[model samples]
Target: MHAATTVSLIPVLSDNYVFVLHGGGSGAAVVDPAVAEPVIAWLEERGLELEAILHTHHHNDHIGGTPGLLQRWPQAAVIASAADRERIPLQTQGVQGGDRLTLLGRHLRVVEVPGHTRHHIAYVLEPQAEEAAELFCGDTLFAGGCGRLFEGTPEQMLSSLQSLSALGTSTRVWCAHEYTEGNLRWAAEREPGNSAIAERLAAVQQQRREGQPTIPSSIGVELATNLFVRAQDAAALRQLRGHKDLWRG
Candidate 1:
């Protein structure tokens, strides 16, 4: 059986999380380092060398630390969307949907999921033996919410979310932000009668109150609680997104 990959979460900024993926090797890769200091320190403390930086979009918070990380490990590969090369100029391995790459002896499939940004993508590392697959989804799909439409339409967002929702129920979803509590609260209010949303909101609130990270949410949990994922169509999704944008509580 293949060795399972190990993922570590490093929280940065106010709510963003930078995921470090290693496979019991000296070389490690990071997914969306919002800032460099924390990630660099984390890798160095473990005596691991940075090998690659995976970017899900061109957003500053997503790709902001690439230059800093690259400065420390000048040869580290910058993997990003080929279509967004102009915006993310640091990209060394510009890829798109349906592409596959190997990192730390593990295989990752690139899945283009544009909605929050025009060229946003996600990385899916399939399960090996007893390990569950992990999905490094940036701002596209949050724990209980989806990113607001910045450059794409509601239809595109819905399609992107639907594609992600189709993954294995046990797939671990590593979203970029810590918005679960707020998202679930909003979901509960949006669908006051939804027991799933209400129950999840309570649990997420408790997690936050205890200062615990409410991330790595599973596909099964999201499908059960995320209103946006449960949205039936583009029209329904559009309404939900609109309401979420104006929601303060």
Candidate 2:
């Protein structure tokens, strides 16, 4: 039997999380590294060599660490969206929607999810023998809220979210930040009577009180409690996004 691929995280820059993927080997791939020092230290401590660096968008926090990481692993491939080359200029492998590539011996599908940024993309690592699928969605989809529409329209964001929603309920959503508690608190206010939201909020509150990270939320949980994901149309999404923008929570 093949060893299942493993995915882990390194928290950095306040709330940002950098993910590392490996399949029981000396090589690993990192996703949306906010900074390099911690990631490099994490990999070096584990005796793993960097094989690739995946970027989901061109935000400074998301791509800032690429140069530093490349300095350490000069030959490591930097994969990013072809359409956003002007912004993420250091990318070595430019890819688009539906494109497939192999990293750490696992297949990953590039999904064009442009809402947070015009050329933002997500990487969907396909499920292996006994491992569940993983979605490194950057800032597009959070635990209980979606990304603020910065460069794309409400319609585009709605479409982008719908595509991600179809990636299967079991897919593990590894978003880029540790914003679950705040997102869910806002969600509970938006949906006061929703038991799922209430239950998740209570559970998440306990987790936070214990100083734990509230991430790796599944699509199933989001479908049930994420008001953004449950928005029925563009107008609804627009209203929600507007409210979220002004929210101080």
Candidate 3:
């Protein structure tokens, strides 16, 4: 409804990507800036001021740019999960599950998706449109795979995935990475004959070959092909996580 608001994803160091979500220009809401230079340059180039920052987790790669960003726009609010207060102490406004906040005129509902980290959260942005929604899941959920359980149990991760899966199938998933090809490769190896795995692998491979990002995945796509989302239960999720962890390819 808001003229297809543009959310630019800027690839930072090696595998990290910081996203800038802004509506009709002038100001932006950044999500997980891994570094400051690129982000600062991007905003300055566009003559945009950072209005707020929504962090998905406390990973150094995720929050590393906060200090520098704040240096440019000191009044901008840093939003993060309340549970990780000590870890993400710089967050100006700590939030939790089921809470809603207004950003760029849209209502973002926080969904506690603890798997990569117990405090990891996904922001389901309810744009003022009739469509399903959009999610900024960070490392918890990826295009073809999910982040490893670093601080939470498989049961909690499975529950988190379940919660995410419950979102409308059309919701757009903005995961912070260009790892779709690698994850699909690993999945295709496990489910050798599976068409879903094969097709996704082919598509992602093509994207990589062309040097294009295979992100902004839809919930429907993940529901149909993401192996992690297909996990039956906690035990299965744990086993899958182990396999993925050791998966060299």
Candidate 4:
């Protein structure tokens, strides 16, 4: 049987994702922690002590909580990409792209999704029989839009997104940032007649209004709607990114 999982999103700042993953009942691992107070409170109340942290990149919002969290759980290991350990100095375990790590009883396949940032990484969690594949991708692949080319080229971003697209169709895409509603809006505007984007936008709007997360979007959903993921090549992705940067809405 698939190992039970609990993925809870603790929203911090404006649009950051602090994903807390609990296995069955007790041990938990947090991904991209921004702030620690709320995360500490939520976990403590649930009797979940911090066991490990998975950092996708070295952005302040992503790694800032590491110090604070370590103060609480002095032994919890911090896992991040080994290539950029200087930037992500808080990490205890530096991993590479092909690393297969076992965290809280689940196997996490590390995939280097370096586009948004040169050394950005994503974790693909695969449980045993009957479990679903889950992707904890940091800002690289948003709902409809992709992250700005901050440190990498469009070619890298396009290739990265394509790699993510090749994951299991049922893979739950847990992307950081609450940009889905705005992304869908932008996508609909770009392709006004595209019914798939329009429908997804309508559904996303309802979820936002209800304060419900529109995330854990399946690979299938993104393949059908995410513009960046479907871009023909890096040039096309670059052109779209340029246009999106200019597009006010």
- Give each prediction's root-mean-square deviation over alpha carbons: 0.8, 0.8, 1.3, 1.1
Task: Write the number of the candidate with greater TM-score, choosing between 1 and 3.
Answer: 1
CA lDDT, every prediction? 0.93, 0.93, 0.89, 0.90
Per-residue lDDT tens digits for candidate 1, residues 56-162, read 99999999999999999999999999999999999999999999999988899999998999999999997787788899999999999999899999999999998
TM-score per prediction, in order, is: 0.98, 0.98, 0.96, 0.97
- TM-score for model 4? 0.97
Query: Order of all candidates by lDDT, from best down to worst?
Result: 2, 1, 4, 3
Instruction: Please give, for residues 199-231, the per-residue lDDT of candidate 2 as tens digits.
Output: 999999999899888889999999989998999
Tell me model 2's lDDT, rounded to 2 decimals: 0.93
Using TM-score as the measure, name the better of candidate 2 and candidate 4. 2
Q: Model 4: which residue pairs collide?
A: none
Q: Write the per-residue lDDT of candidate 3 for residues 1-249, one digit (tens) a residue.
A: 455557789988997889888778577999998899999999899999899999999999999999999999999999999989899988999999999998877789999998899899999988565655878999888998998899999998888888988997898889987788888888888889899889888888888788888878988999988889999988888998999899887
How many residue pairs clash (N, CA or C atoms closer than 3 angstroms) in each of the candidate models, in the order given?
0, 0, 0, 0
Model 3 TM-score, 2 decimals: 0.96
lDDT of 1 at 109: 97
Off by over 4 Å in 1: none
